[model samples]
Target: MRFIKFFFIVLGFSFLQSCSNPSLYQSKHYVFGTIVDISIYGEDEKKAEKVTKAVLEEFTRLHNSLHAWEKSDLTDLNESISKNKPYKNASSELIEIIKNARELERASNHLFNPAIGELINYWGFHQNEFNSMHPNQLKIKNLVARGPSLDQLHISGSTIKSTNPHVKIDLGGYAKGYALDQASKIIHEHHIKNALINIGGNIMAIGQHGNKPWRVGIQDPRGAQAIAKVDLLDGWAIGTSGDYQRYFINDGKRYCHLIHPFTGYPVQGVYSATVLIEPSQNAGTLSDVLSKPLFISKKEDRKDIAKKLRIYHYLIIEDKHISMTKAMADKIQFLNPNTQKNNQIEITL
Candidate 1:
């Protein structure tokens, strides 16, 4: 006999049902300021629960280690660079994250820098309080002066040193994707053939649903409704970054959470960016890190960069216009554009 249940809870809800003989499908959410929704497709409920717990635990561990606002975390490492002291042998996990971040910085021509933590704080995006005050010109100049390039980081095995004492590292751009990658590995090792992991805005899909691709909806930046839907077959990952997720309004102007490291101001022109990639141990970390830079780049320059990196399947929504890369346009199939009354333009990637 197959058993399934669906229940709605105020804080978190679960939807579970059995389709194939023994295989079950379940979706649930975990809340921590933001909610992480996870969907599992498998036969063993006990095993699925265990895998889910492991994935969540890994997320918690990474959050505690990398969150800059947490005073108890190793944030002191960001300030001790002037002493010529290397960060005390960091965990192998953190070391790998740092290495990947540095590589991304180089790949994006310093557009995707991890050494912008101090700048992030100065802009007040890290604070939960929504304030629309922009930093002054002098403050912006000082912060930019203190910024460190990826080359300034020296790493040997698990040890890391910073050439600039003012350089502080923030993993907000890539940590969730890295965590999802690690969690997916854990699930696969447990022999779970199908699963979906969503950490905040980062999403990963493995296997299929009843021989059909898992369906993911890309939310509209202007509202809560989904504007586009993409199918994930044989496992893929998708990530979306937008100004709509977090913002504050002041004097009739809205300030978004994503700040431009160069100007110490919020990034403009583009409203949202969504990236799709094959999910592996790294999932879509590279894509997530590159999205912001791609969003702010000129149309021609963005196309050139995407082609150089061999990223053809991505979407950018800017100035209320939608554009898709030729590579991405050929693969993505849109389901519902008129689902809601909101205005959304869809383009083939």
Candidate 2:
């Protein structure tokens, strides 16, 4: 049944309903380079269908506007800005995304940088074509020394200009979460009380599964299965970043797409990071972007930065141990497969 898919591979939400009932309605679309799944409950079939349509339409709109690698609205904006065009036009939504990205870059202490698009392409992440070869040391050193950041971006009215000629914007990390938040808005606007949206395993939920809260599986970085599960109440979002998702191995070393802005290399030390935050327009985006900093930050600074960003619940898993905030430890149940690993530790913050 679909519940098995949710509980196992996709890290999706498993409803409390029976498989034979089939009362809940589900719709799936391929957009934003991930499977966008919407499940709606507590509404008639027709209304649920309509709500799903609205949500998918919103995703489509966002995919067209925000995609970095594709030939879309974002591509045009990036091209114009790179060419030093005079005060080019952009949608208000795009402007808001850039603005939020800049704020997040500062809030995360410049760890989560969207302005490293050149470095990203250099590593072949932009093409999904990691050849199991690292970039030349000179190139890496030059990029690192240059240190492009969103601070170089200046937005005014509907136009944006980059103060640093090397600055290039790629919103891949933040755009999916933003799109999911928009989908949630559409679901709520339709008054669909019980709904769950999972975009490439970045999940957000509203209402409940009948009388029970939605249960989500957090995937293990070591394998495809979920090592833990967390119950999510209404208006909560969770996003996870893991090296296992997009990486290539060279010799015995592993390289991933989540690059460290300062070093211009893939981040290490944490295999996976999961964050749970209160819902908002930026909640999903924050969840997605915050995980990188939490995973890559100094051990002592993780909690401080998390709290500074208003993220009360988060988990960081390394090779030998798992550490999490109390808010997360309280809500998560480790699956039996991970019960005796002896590395599950909790922190109070």
Q: TM-score for model 1?
A: 0.85
Candidate 1 weakest ten by summed lDDT: 3-12
What digit string (tens of lDDT, one per residue) describes model 1 on residues 111-169? 67778877787766665564667458798888887767667988787677888877777
- Residue-level lDDT of model 2, residues 1-349, one tens digit each, is 0001121233333453433346677777888776777877667789988888888888888888877777778778667667877446777878888888889889889878898888887887776344677469899989888778879778888878876767777887898788877887788787789988888888887887767777788987876678898877788888888877777777778787888888888887788889998766667777678887887787888878887777889988887778888878888888865444667575766
Cα RMSD of all models vs. native, in order, equals 6.3, 3.7
- What TM-score would every model get versus the actual structure? 0.85, 0.92
* Candidate 1 Cα deviation (angstroms), residue 214: 0.6
Could you tell me how far off, in angstroms, the CA of residue 23 lies in candidate 2 after the best superposition? 1.8
lDDT at residue 254 of model 1 (Cα atoms) = 61
